[model samples]
Structure formats: structure tokens, C-alpha cells
Target: MGSVTTKKHQNGLDYVEVSTDLCQARIFLQGAQIDQFTPTGKAPLLWVSAADDYQVGNGIRGGIPVCWPWFGMSGNGGFPQHGFARTRLWSLDSINMHDEIVDLIFSLKLTEQDRQYWPHDTEVKVLFTLSDTLSVSIVNKNNANYPVSLTQALHTYLPINDIHQLSATGFDGSKYIEFGEGPYQQPNDKVNFDKETDRVYTDLSPVQHLHTPTGIIEVSRENSQSAVLWNPWIEKSTRLSRFKADDYLTMVCLEAANVLDDKVTLSPGETHTLTTHIRWV
Candidate 1:
């Protein structure tokens, strides 16, 4: 069984670090994000930018940022980008350790500050399972009388030895839409990174393999209809805050999401969960 402890970080934020015989990980109360995951005999599967701002109320540049209720530009005037869940602080609900796995649960609910963005009652809980591999499950519980329609994503940043050496299989023949364009059918048998790449692939398979110079990474998920792949290359990277101009050379994002026509609608008292599993092969 693994062990969990709460401690104030050097950056002035509180986080939970878990260590077991199989692996080690760090999860922050902010966004309930898992910033680090390193298996015993393997390299890290998750990554955070060295230029990231650790200040509270500021979004961390990497790891897993839970984009909820809405994703990207909310398309609603005056609403925060990627919703308010990632920047707000979350509460650690519980920590349960069992043989071969460690579970950490966190919850975030509406507060006085949240009224400006979402006045309705809603709760978000994220559960992280750590073992030789990593698994994340996010649950949205709606308490309002009416149903809400929204898109969400488990924005994951994967570490790589070099972005140029990266390739992803399983996207061939899948339909995708670039960040600003309309839907287009994929023509490539495999996906690779060259310049800035941002596309949303729909109707995905359950498993995907990311090939990197250091190793091969396997990403699998349940209840996911969309997979968003992004790598803000040189130009965009320079304009990004809390990110180095060249940081994109070392990381890639393959997110499990429900976006576009696949948005989720939850009625009052309803709950929806999205889960993803990742490992280095």
C-alpha cells in the first residue's frame, strides 16, 4: 500500500505527494491536477513546464488541468477561459490506500466567488489512482433543477524526449477538426508533430500509443468520444504566459474530451464521469 501526506510546497501552494513501491506522484489542490507521475523503473509520464507560475489563482502551465462545464473559449461573453474549476482551490476529500494502488479524491463546489461565472449549484470531484500506471476519473454532479449542456476535457500534458521524435498511432481514418477549421477527415495513417498542431479527433479508439525517442506511451480511456491533440510550436509558445518559447519541444497534449456535437448534458441530480489511463511502455 502507498502512503499520502499533505505539505506546503516551495511555491507556497499545498499539495499531496504519494509514494508507493510501484511509483511516486504529486497532486495539487489547485484543479486537483496530477503534476507528476513516475513509475519505479520508468521515466515520468506527466510533465509540467519549468516556466510555470506556481502562484495561487494562476493556472499551472502543465500536467492535467481539468477543463470543465466548458472548454477553450466558452463562447459566452465575460466567462473565464476553460471554466473556473482549474484556477480555484479544491478540497482534499479523502485518501484511501489499497494493495497495488493509491487513491486520492478531491472535490470543488460553488462558492461566493463562483457566483459571477456559474451561479447554479454544481460539484466537481476528481479521483486519481496511482500504481505502476496512472488513472484519473472526473465526476460532475449537478444540483440545479434544470439540465446544463457543456463540454469538458482532461487536459493532459505528456513528457517527451523530443517533440520532433514523437508520433501517435490509432488516429488514422479518424475524423478531426483543426482548432479554427471545420471538420475534416484524416488522411494520414499516423499523426506526427512538425509545426504547431491543434486538432480534435472524434470517435476515438480505446487505446493510443505515443511514440517518443525515450519510450512508447500508452494512453487509454473510458467513456470518451473526443481526443484533442495540441502542441503549440515556436510561434505560439513565445506568446504563451508562464511557458518558455521552446517548451513545446518537450511536451505534447493528448486530451480525453467530449466536445463539439459530443457535449454532455446532465439533468438535476445527475452525475457524469470521464476516465483516462496512462502509462509508459
Candidate 2:
């Protein structure tokens, strides 16, 4: 079994690239927690952003970045937006390679620094495995002797040439809370975004599909209840320096998430796992 290690280059830049026989995938990582995602291979299939190169235009945030106790600004979470998982560095515990596949496990131990945001003693492990298919597993171990509530998501930004011509299936009959003044409740299944939108959908099956003009993207999840679909669209895109207003036509954020609105509880010493597997045809 071998592991992924880092070496600094003479350019004074430290970047992490996947070294694997699985040429279909590449895990581009950075020491800076807030740095946007980069794709070297199959990842580029996940997203190609016209706005910024570092930001993952449309691929799942490839590793398990915990979204503890809350999903966005919804009050249930006491920390800042989207939790603290993204802005922190995770320690690579081990890496194992077998045949043509590479598996890397990353762990983050809750410390006083994490307690400052939310008081909880937790051990989070993220396993990234690449083979013919790309998969991620998030394991949460609660060290406390009581129950803990958390909300989370695997935020995937999927690549697209034209968002207008694509449609998402699997959420059709599910319920969703619109993130706007209306805050309307609606069914899932097939959604077409005509205006600015942000909302969390509750009640999901194990699988969802994204159909584009080129091909179809199938997303399968385990122990996840929500799916998020996002595109900056027109007006919102104009406001973003990273994204041009019309650039929204090329990318979309399709996330498999468990929002605070629908919380998951784990008893003391209990462990919970969240998983998602992606494939396209």
C-alpha cells in the first residue's frame, strides 16, 4: 500500500496532485483551506469554469468537507455560512493503492479551534477512492457520550456546455423550500431554473440523474436526504467577479446535501457515514 505525499516545488508554490494509474481522475488540492478546487483529469469532466480556474465550476467538492450542525445561514448552525470544513486543512491519515486504483484517507480532529465555532468533540474522516468510478465517503465519529445533531452536504459542481438544455431527475416529487421572498414549497423530479434560486430539497431517493445535451450524469448517494441545484444565472452572475453574468449557461452546482432543516443525529460513540458515487454515459 502506498500513499499520496506532498513535495514543494522550486516555484515556491506547494500543490497536491494525484499520482495514480487511474488516469480518469485527479485530486487537485491546496494547503490553503479556502482555495477553490482544481481538476487535472476526470475532474475536469466535473467542471470547467469560465469565471475562475481555481474554483470548481461543477464537480462535487471532491473530499468530505464536514458541514457541521448547519447547512447555510439557517439559524440551526451557529458557525459561519457553509460551516468551517472548507476553510480548514485536513490531515491525510493514510493512502493505499491496489492494482489500478488509489485510495486516500483524510482526517480532521476537532480541537479547541473547532470548539470556538461549535462545541463538539468529533473525529471526521474523508476517504477518496479513484478507480473506473470516483467515490467519496464521509465518516463522523462522535466521541461525546450524548447525541449530536448535524447538517451536511456533498456540494457537486457538474460540468455543462449549456444549462438551459439540461434537466435533473430524481427530485420530482420531493419537497423543497425556495430560497427567496416566496420561500415556496414545491415538488422536485424535474427542475428548470429561470431566475436566481437557492433552496434545499428534503426527501430524496438513493439516485439522481443530470441529463445534458452531450450525455447524462448519474449521481448515487447513501444516507443523504437533499439535493441542491444552483446556477448564478443572469443578474447574479453580473455581480460575481469570478463569474460573468451569461457564463452561467456553461455550469451548474448540483449538490447532494443534508441540510440543517433536516438534521441527522448521532448518539455518543456512534458513527455516521455519508457517501456519493458518480458516473456518466
Candidate 3:
């Protein structure tokens, strides 16, 4: 059996911490963002910045940051990148324990101020199922009379023993665009990082394997066709907030996303869900 409790960080943000026979995890209510997950006898499966301030209204540097309504820049300019959902506080709806598995549900309802940034009537909820494996799902329901379109991602930061010793598989033959550049087809069986890489891949397999020196981590997604693989390497890492210059060598982000043509569109009374399951294999 497991127990769930709410704890406050020194910076005044509240989060839910879970302890079970199988694993332990932490999820901040501010973004419903998970910052830590570890199996009983394994190293952490997620990576977080050592420099993260854990302050209010700021997204934490790692784990899974839920990007909703929009991803990256909103194109309208002056609006916060990756939308406002990650900055707003969410409600802890429920916590249920099923033997060794613990389920935590966090929800966010669009506020009047949220409408100024994203003019839509939608309800959002994120479910974190923790066991020996971790599964995260984000559900969006359109409550308005008109249709709405949005792009989102579960920005997941994964730990690595070494960047040079890592290779990611499952993207071969997929179409990808690098930094808005060419829509190139992946020609290699595996992708190894040697430089800064920002790629959005579409039409890829739902399962990806991250081969690290220590072991393999399997990342599988549902209701997503687009995924983003990113690593700042050296230069860009220096300029990122709450991140160290050399942090890129130890962490990489393989996000399950809906971007470009994979964006979601929902009519009135419609609902959409995006999910990602991760575990050591």
C-alpha cells in the first residue's frame, strides 16, 4: 500500500508527494508537473535541474511540464511560451491507492484571466498513475459552443549516464523538421547526439527506446503522432533558465507532443486525451 500527502516547498509552492511499495514520486500542483519518480530500487527515471528555484509562477526545470493550449511561442507575441497552464495552480482532485499502485488526479479549470491568453472554454485534468512504472495522461474537454484548436506536449526530461553513450531508436523512417528547417526523413536506425538537436518528428512509432549506458528506458505514447527530441548540448544550455551549462550532457527531452499538422481540434462538447507511459526495460 501507499500514502499521498501535500507538502509545501520553501519557495511557497504546494505539491503532492507519493510513497508506495513500488515507487515514490513528487508532483507540483502549480503545473501539475511531476519533478521526480523512482522505482523502489532504481535510480530516478526523470531528470530535473539542480538550479530550479521552485518559485511561484515559474515552470520547474524538469520532469514532465504539461504544455497545453499551445507549445513554444504563441505567434501572437508577448504571451508566455508554452501557454499559462503550467504557471497556474491546479486542484488536487483525488488520490486512490490500488495495492502497490497510486493514482493522483489534478485538475485545472480555465479562469477569466486564462481566457485572455487562450480564448477557450475548456477543462483540463492530468492523471498520474504511479507504480513500478509511471503513466501520465492529460485530458481536455471543450465546454464552449464553438470548436477549438491547440497544440500540446508532455515535455519529459529523461536522465542519462552520458550523452555520448546514448542512442535513441524508433524514429527511423519518420519525417522530422529540425528547428523549422527541412522536413527530412530520418535515415539512421538510431539517433546519437553530438550537437544541439531540436527535432519535431511526425508519423513515428508510438514506442521509443532510450539506450543509456546503464540500461534501456522504454517510452510509449498514446493519442500522439508528433514527438520532440531535444538536447541543448553546450551553448544553448548556458542561456536556459534554471538549467546549468553542462546539464545537457546528463539530460535529454523526448516529449510526446501534438505539433504542426498533428495539433488537436475539438468541436463543441468534444474531448481529447494524450498519454505517455515510461519505464525501465
Candidate 4:
């Protein structure tokens, strides 16, 4: 097994780096309060919802977070929800910091512990660069001399004063299979929120802007064909938590991901990478 360690910077921010020669990731706790997640740096890339009254499920909610090969309840995979990646500790490979940016790299490998669940020898690397723009890159390689299947994403939670006042672009005119609903449908070009919305959009071009009454955040992606936009709003977030009763009002989950039936496949010695960049305006 690999080891876990912590390193703090002069900027008053700290990171918990997890590693093995094969794979690695960083988890930031400061972003935890807001449900934002990051494998490195101070910002919450995504939010893993707390046990609160407003939560909808016990999964990642806010931040530019990681979502491995499979997510949610799976009858086919026979593995845990969201795969074994998030709960597993990742180690740091390298770090470079400056006044305006911080870059972090992490690595992990298939272990005896991990293989028992999903037997495969693979190398997963996550690179997070938080500069004037926050960028997250995930690369996976099939090292076992055989083909493998995986699903993944960088779940992001953007800050907003109100969920109703927010709207996102880029997924417009695209078709999606609603997570809570029955079938796939095309979302109107102009996005709007009225209920619990979970949908995976395929064949996305690139560059989408999430607009709020206050400001707009632009998300750009490469080699990512799918993106999931979700908000539990009033009723859904209530059941997923065990603690706070009002935590849902302040956050929402907008993930750049490949989930459900959409999986990434790699051949032996073959590697694939997904990258997302976030800029606040």
C-alpha cells in the first residue's frame, strides 16, 4: 500500500496528498464546508454533500471534484456507488506554486485492496492546476495488457446566491437523458431550472458558460463529450443528508463528467485524458 501525507503552504492553505506510483489525488478540507472539491490547491472543485437536512444524496455536490468510471446506484457493476476512487486516498506527485497559480499532480494504481472489488491493473493520474484559471486534467491508462472500461468526471460546484437565478450555456440544443426522469430528451437552447434536473449530454462541442444574476463562470473542456447539470432545489436535497437542514440553499452541482452508460475504454498501453478549465468573470 502507498502512504498519505499533508503539506501546508505560506498562503494559509493546506492539502492532503495521497499517492502510489500508479495513481494519486489531493483532497482539500477547507472547500468541504461549501461542498467544493479539489485534488489540490485551496478552492473546492466540487462539493461532497454533508449529512444535512438539505442534501439530496450522500455523494459529491460542489467543487471541481473527481468521479471515477462509475457513479450512482449500479446493478451491473456490482461495485460500490461512484466506484472505489473517491473514498480511496490519493498521493501527490508534484507541486508548483506562485503568486497567481498553484499546480498539483497525483497518482494511484490498482492494488490488492482495489483489485478485489474491480479486478484490473490500471494507472490513474489526476493533475490540478489552479492559476488565474482553474484546470483539472484526468488521465487513465490500461496497463494490464488488456482492454478496460471506466467512467469519470470532475464534478464542480459553483457559488451562487440563489439557485433559481442561475443558468448555464453550452448544453443548449443538445440531447440528454434525465437522471431522475425516464428517457432522453433535447434541452431547450436557453437553459432554465424548475425542478430536480440530472442529465448527461453527449457530443458536446466545447466551452459553456454558467450565468448567474451576479456573474458568469465559463467552463471549457477538451476530450470530454458529456456534462451533467444538477440541482436538487427544494425537495430532493432534503433526504440525502444527516445533519444540517438548510445546507442546500447555498450550493448546486454542475459536473463535467462521463457517467451511467457512457464509459471510457482503453486498450493495453493506451491512455486517455479529460481536461476542464474554469474561469470566473
Candidate 5:
């Protein structure tokens, strides 16, 4: 059996803490983000920055940040990077416990200020299932009469013993576009981190395996054809907010995304759900 309780973090953010027979987790109301998840006897499957201040307006540097409405820069200089969803507070709508599993639903309130960035009648919510494995789903419903476009990602930061010793699979034949680089094909079967890497992969396999020194992590996605693999490495880490310069050595992001050509355009009254499941194998 599991129990859910609310506690205020030292940073003044409110979060739901779950302790179950199978696992323990924390879900922050802000961003509806899961910053800590660890199966009862296993190592942590997620990572957070030690330098994060956990402020109200600033996005947390690690865990899972919901990048909604848009991903990355919106091209409009005035718009915030990676949209505004990660900075807004979400309401915990429901909590259901099934034996050792706990399901939490969080709904975001769209305000008049949000319409200035995206003018559409839309409803967004996130469902997190905590058990032996962690599963998350972001549901977007178009409430408008007209169509709406959306690009989003579950920006997941994974822990690693060392970035230099990590290798990932599931993008062998996928087409990837690096930041300010070509749409190149991944020639190698395994991806190794050495330098700064920022890649948006399309036509990718739904499942990916991260071989870390600690163990293997299996990441699978549903209703998503694109993914982003990023690491600030050395130089960029120094400039990243709420992140330590050496943080890149122990963390890597393997985001399940809907970006580039995989972006979604929802018809009126349509709903789209993006889900990702992560587990230690």
C-alpha cells in the first residue's frame, strides 16, 4: 500500500510526497514535475541539480520539466524559452492508489496572460504513475473550434556515473539535426558523449537504452516520433542557470519530444497524449 502527503520544500514550493511498498517519489505542484523517483531498493532513476534555487518563477534545472505549447526558443525574442508551462503552478486534481501503485493527476490553469503567448482554448494535464517503474503522460485537449499547434517534450534528466563512460542505443538509423548543424544520419549504433551534444532525432525507435556505469536504464515513449538528446558538457554548463559546471559529468537528458516535423496539430476537440515510461533493467 502507498500513502500520499503534501509537504512544503525548504525552497517554499509545495510537493506531493509518495511512499509505497515499491517506490518513493516527489511531485512538485510547480511545473507538475517529478524531481525525485527511486524504486525501493534501486538507485535513483532521475537527477536534479544541486545548484537549483527552486524559485517560483525559474524553472528547475533537473528532474522532468514539462515543455509545453512550444519547445526551445519560440523565435519571438519576447517569448520565454521552452514556453511557460514549466513556470506555472498546476493543481493536483486526483490521486488514486492501486495496491503499490499511485496515480496522480495534475491540471494546469490557462490564464489570460498565457493567451498572449498562445491564443487557443486548450486544456492540459499530466498524469504520473509511481510504482516499480515510473510512467508519465501529458494530455492536451483542444477546446477551441479551430485547430491548434503544439510542440512539447518531457525533458528528463537521467543520472549517470560518468558521461564519458555512458553509451546509448536506439538511434542507429534515425535522422538527427544538431544545433546549427546538418540533418545527418547517425552512422554509429551507439551514441557516446564526449563533447557538447544537442540533437533532435526524428524517425526514431520508441525504446532507448542508456548503459551507465551504475546500471541500464530503459526509456520508452508513446505517441511521439521525435526525441532530443542533450548534454551541456563543459563549456555550456557554466552558463546554464541553476546548474553546476560539473553537473554535465553526472547527468544527461534523453527527452521524449514532439518537435520538428513530428510537431502536433490538433483538430478541434481532439486530444493528444504523450507518454514515457522509465525503468531500471
Candidate 6:
């Protein structure tokens, strides 16, 4: 019913290949990043940039980039932005094939080298359940005696027919922190990209729908308290590495995150899982 394979991807990165009657997917061992997923009888749902070179140790412009330990710049002046998970290679722990679905477990442990940034004993893993729909479960377990506080995000880039015409419905009356700064606004209409849009929203809405000319796409999550709506527009889009300046017109990111006031605190022996589910209609 399903199969798993391995292949050498861009710049010598290794990725696990999954194939089933219901869908096809590719998960890079580096950062456990998923670059592609297409369910049967549906249009391609995920988005990747045309300028992506897939260079080793560099985060691809699109796909699900797991930002862990910290989401944005931690202001340390020494740590890498979006943590080191996206640059480090993850170990594939297990893979199981069922009647019509496939499950793959990938693990990453905090190493001595990683301690210099935010020293904490931790274990991170993501379970990818791929079938007609895609579900990614990111689990963080704290091993340190003291409580560890951190922020993480599943940077999910979604494909749409057009960015200008796309409408995201769900946060009709919610407030958002624009560009990580203050003066959060409560939009009167659904999300529509007029220009550079980067906002972090709280209130923990459970479901969001991205409406395109073709159809409406559903994004659902569990155990997530924050969502990031982003489209680099012109200025930041041109500055982005491995991304075309005009690529934002075809893609938008609605990420599941726990940041700022929603930052997660995990005590010793405690674990937290943030999950995101995507489907197209």
C-alpha cells in the first residue's frame, strides 16, 4: 500500500521518499523539511520557490521549515535566526506503512555544539503522517531539570492561484502583531495581500480557509496558540535568499506557531506537540 525510499537531494542532502496510492511526498533529512506533497485527485498544495538551489545547510525558500528552540531572531547577536534545526540533519528513527497511509518518525537531539546558543537538554522529533491529507506533528521534550522556554513555528508555505485575489477566512475579528512590533490591528476583512504582510496572530482559532479562484483550501491545527500570516511582497522578497523576487505572487505562508506571549514552557520530563493539518477542496 505504501513504500519508503532514500535519495540524494540538492547539494548532497538526504531525503526520504514516500509513495502511496493516496499521495506522494519528499521529506529531507536535513531539518526534517518536507518540500513536496501532492494528494491524489487534487492540485499540488505546497509551494516552493523557483529560485531555490537546495544548497546544503541553507533553508529552502519554501516548504515546512521547522523553527525550533526559538522562532525569530533571539537578539543574541551570535545565534542563527530560526534556530539550527533547519540547518542540521535529522536522524530517521522509524518508518511504518499501513493500508493506505505512511508514518515516518525523525529525531534530533540537542548536542554540545548546540548548547552554546540556548543551552538545554532537549529531544525533538516530527512525525509525518502522509496520505490523502498531510499532518505533521512536532514534539518537543525537555530533559533539563529547569523549565525551558522557547518558541517554535511550522513555517508552512501554501500554494494559491493568485496572491492578490486569495482570501484567508477565520480571523475575522482577531488582533495581530504586525511585523513583530506593537499596535496590533483587528482587520475588518479577511486576509488579503495588498503589500508586504507579516503579522502574528493569537486567540487560537482552530480552522482557517484560504479561498482561491479554483477552490477553497482548509488549514487546521491542534495545540497551537498562534498563527503567522506572511507574504514578503516586494522589498523583503527580493532580499530573500533562494527565492525569486516575484515568487510571493503565487504563494503565501500561514504558519502554526507559539511565539511571544504564546511561547511554550516545558518543565523537565514534559513534552508538547504542535500539529498542522492541510487539505484542499
* Model 5 pairs whose backbones collide: none
Whole-model Cα lDDT per candidate? Answer: 0.87, 0.62, 0.92, 0.62, 0.94, 0.88
Candidate 3: regions farther than 4 A off: none
TM-score of each: 0.96, 0.81, 0.98, 0.77, 0.98, 0.96
Error of 4 at 160 (Å): 1.8
Clashing pairs in model 6, backbone N/Cα/C closer than 3 A: none
Q: How big is the positional error of residue 107 in model 5, measured in Å on the Cα after superposition?
A: 0.5
Please give the range of 10 consecutive residues that has the lowest summed lDDT in model 2: 31-40
Per-residue lDDT of model 2, residues 92-180, tens digit only? 66767788577777776666777777787777777776665667777788888888888777666677678878887777557766664
| Ranking according to lDDT, highest score first | 5, 3, 6, 1, 2, 4
Clashes of each: 0, 8, 0, 38, 0, 0
The Cα error of candidate 4 at residue 12, in Å, is 17
Which parts of model 6 are misplaced by more than 4 Å? 183-185
Candidate 6 C-alpha lDDT tens digits along 1-281: 67899999757989998888999899998899999999988887799998999988798888899998799898789889999998888999998888889999999866778878867888889999998889998898988899998899999999987898999988866678885586465666477778999888887587899999887889888888788989999889889888898898899999989887888899999999999999896
Identify the candidate with maximal lDDT. Answer: 5
Which residue ranges in model 5 land beyond 4 Å of their true spot? none
Q: Which stretches of candidate 4 lie over 4 Å from their true place?
A: 1-26, 29-61, 76-78, 98-100, 180-183, 242-244, 260-262
- Per-residue accuracy of model 1 over 53-85 as CA lDDT, tens digit each: 788888788889999778888877988898888
lDDT value for candidate 5?
Answer: 0.94
Evaluated at residue 101, the lDDT of candidate 3 is: 93
Over the stretch 229-278, how does candidate 5's per-residue lDDT look in tens digits? 99999999999988999999999999999999999899999999999999
Question: Backbone clash tally for model 4?
Answer: 38
C-alpha lDDT (0 to 100) for residue 173 of candidate 1: 64
For candidate 1, the 10 contiguous residues with the lowest summed lDDT are 113-122
